[model samples]
Target: MEPRSHKLYHLHGFHSRNLLDTYCSSKAEMPFTYEAFMYPMEKFHNAFSSGDFRGDVLIDFSIGPQIQHLYAAQEHFRDIILLKPTEHCILEVKKWTDSRTGAFDWSHTTTLATELAGKSDQSEEKEIRLRAAIKHVVKFDLNQENLTGSIGLPQADCLVFWNILEAISKDLKEFVRNFRKFSKLLKPGGRIMHYGALNCTFYMVGGEKFHFFKYNESDFRSMLSNEGFVITHLEVSQRKAESDLMDFDSVMFCTAYKE
Candidate 1:
């Protein structure tokens, strides 16, 4: 069956190019230099234009197509679909809340927290607490089950799971098992892009807990190799989190082909 769409989730704030711009703009006090800003943008453009990233139907599954550069490449694809997971997740969460609670009680924060914790233990309680507050006011729930079977991506030529592995659990075995399931979602021979930070904090998605794992290049490469993927490209970038006061000196971005 022909796939209905190509889904690219969390592209708004998480796209590397967007992040680079934020990084540059935040450091505007250092020097008002257009060269510094243009350099990264050019790099991102080149990467996307390259043959490695291919899909006729592109989907932006974030808040929206917040990326300004992608507009320039609209001609390169047949269709571009933009979706907001936040909205859907919120809707699902709300439905769940209403089902559990007879009436909409905006003050019921603990119940959401309990639900998020039960979904994933690695989730940050503080983040969950904060999301619960907003969720109570919003019209939706952000649970994973709500997301299941929702993403309809075209038969992807290549699938990129960039920088997301590090945000999963540290248990390598469990991580590989989970990833294998993700890989199966791809068409045979499709490429898999894997990017990981050496050390990073767990993330909370709309009140859900997602853990982070740290690994060196060798360790991660081996994991991919064992998973039946041929390592194509590996690039390392430095990661610094001022809020968390953590610095992951090296982050690896790997391009692997499913054989």
Candidate 2:
């Protein structure tokens, strides 16, 4: 593990909240920078509203308790499994999944989703739908052969992860290894959809800096191709959040199917 790996810190000690509020906020001192990220997310999730990629089960490899990215998937995937690295992240997901108190309020994101889908005033229904769609939140480890301990999880129809690669992977080899492992969780024609930051060296959480993998577009395209995946869709946005909270030059959204 690298010296700055997030494994060195306690996730419950404000990492989740700090990561979200910093990058997810559009009202920050450098709002344009944050707004740059919002574009890809809004555009990406909105595409899920259509049924082009509906599936029986979808796995979400979330870096933290991020529910905003799962809203559009709710209407498409009947069963969703959320994979978190720590117990704290798992509990945070369950809190919102069960509608418990103090769960991070993602209502604004829900509102944005509904509005984008041209279904304004449907935030409550959308939230309820996502809560029900999430069937389980399991602790996961990419380094393990099985990832989810010994649980024999069924191969999913689709797997979608957001930025977890940069958070956990220490180097290029590990990043490639992660994709190899992720392939085993899918059926023959199953696809992997992802959103990742580009050219990011590090990001701050609760005032603590952690390692963030520095990679770019060609790296992903080459990695996916060599790792038995055929790139189908890819879009990258230049860095907009010009804040010191994180140093990412761009963000990437990609979809690839196992070959």
Candidate 3:
């Protein structure tokens, strides 16, 4: 049965507790918010290691404090920039990036990544590499025409986006608009690596409602193409269990290059 009957709640805010305790946690710990993310993470790892998407700069246009997507790009990019939309998220990411006191644990993710790479659970080494690879974690507002005007940042060679467009957008047009703005920050012919929830409309974060635009694989591909992108790789993981924490049919992963 659906948790809370998948009831609708007015979209109000982003909850840190929800983000840390559920969405970012592993399926073993958070079956409701996370559903087997390691599969997509492994796919991304293979795609980046194939030598087709290496770059000098890789920008993480993330909505929350997600770093799993970067596990693949660390070897493929020289510098990594993490962009957050809210102060809370920025602080959350800083807690991990700066190795601050009482940071949210990502040990499971580290272990999973190492195992996927054919290594024997070298989580400490993986964590060290991830910390060394991150160059900056800064605030970024998608509503702005100049995303990082204050810092005067250069365009990125590749952008990693996940769990943002749908969670915050109320409609498809807004999704496209925000997507175009983010794409503009990429250099010509640069690539975009994306992860999205499919057929999700609303989700709960710390008992507060967060909205998601309903969309499927077709909608996503069409939107990417409309914005001058060619998808080179795509994968989707069908949801295995139902929960009140999040209502999504599947998770989608894709790599696309601007035309």
Candidate 4:
């Protein structure tokens, strides 16, 4: 017999969990606000679940455990990089644990960007732009961590970094640094997609507040070009069935590739 019920449950799980989490955890703190994390978390999960690329290696910076869940459920098991210890948790526990004492290592940003760009296909202008677009985004950054030992995979065909750029507080320099890190994660001819909000605010584990970097279509496209990515698909839509929880017009979805 066809496993009709199994298929149905799998299909409904994303929306059901998203809705339930949102309603149940609205008043909770950073990680506890399940909807805030699950919405984007599921989006990224669904993308991999679609199985279009079935990447040889998937590096998810800052979202290790979420990806681990998806990997466990799916048969397509690629090497995964859960950058830093924070990948295992909803909040940056390392940063919180050493908030007063921890020092930020800014060099990793440039190093990662250079690495991703180096691995990308380098054709003429248009081709290069197209590839980079598939690789990087306006707000998010991808960085390399010392997790290669844990992931135990070779070089990745696709690198997926989740929820890095969305938390940047200040300094355009910091933003640029993150952009570079994201750009370097992709191998040549690999693809990248990022999910970011228009205008949103939330609190973290340490009671620190973070907001999205306000961006429109023009600004977004410009950032892509600056990072040497060609914009393939950019979509903006309002959140359905929900009031303005964060005082924003819409959510931005971007998909691009590295050349």
Question: Runs in model 2 with CA error above 4 Å?
Answer: 1-14, 25-37
**Full candidate order by lDDT, most accurate first:** 3, 2, 1, 4
Candidate 1 lDDT, 1-259, residue by residue in tens: 1111212223212332332333223343423122222322233344555666565544332221122223222324444333233454334334433345432222222233233234334324433333332222221112343323454445545444434444433457755765665565456777654444565444323223334554677777787789788887777655433333223555555667888
> By TM-score, is 1 or 2 better?
2
In candidate 2, what are the lDDT values of residues 1-259, reduced to their tens digit? 3435553322333456666666564454634433434575575575575455678999988667787777778888889998787877778778888889887777767878788778888889999998999999998775577999887788898898788877777779878887677668898888888888898877777777777778889999999888888887898877765568677887788888888
- The best candidate by lDDT is 3
Badly placed stretches (over 4 Å) of model 1 are 1-44, 57-147, 150-152, 201-211, 238-244
TM-score of 4: 0.51
| Model 2: ten consecutive residues of lowest lDDT | 5-14
Q: Against the hidden true structure, what lDDT does model 4 obtain?
A: 0.41
User: Candidate 4 lDDT, tens digit per residue, 1-259?
Assistant: 1222111111121232232233223343323233333344345445555665466555555321232122221234334444433222323223322333432221222232223335323223322232232221111212335223333344556555444454442334555666665556567776666665555443222222234444556666677778777666667666542443334455565666665
Predicted candidate 3 versus true structure: per-residue lDDT over 171-232, tens digit per residue: 78877887887788799999988887799877767766567778899989899988889999
Clashes of each: 13, 2, 0, 15
TM-score of 3: 0.90
Stretches > 4 Å off in candidate 4: 1-46, 49-52, 63-65, 68-77, 85-154, 169-173, 201-208, 240-248
Deviation from native of the Cα of residue 70 in model 3, angstroms? 1.1
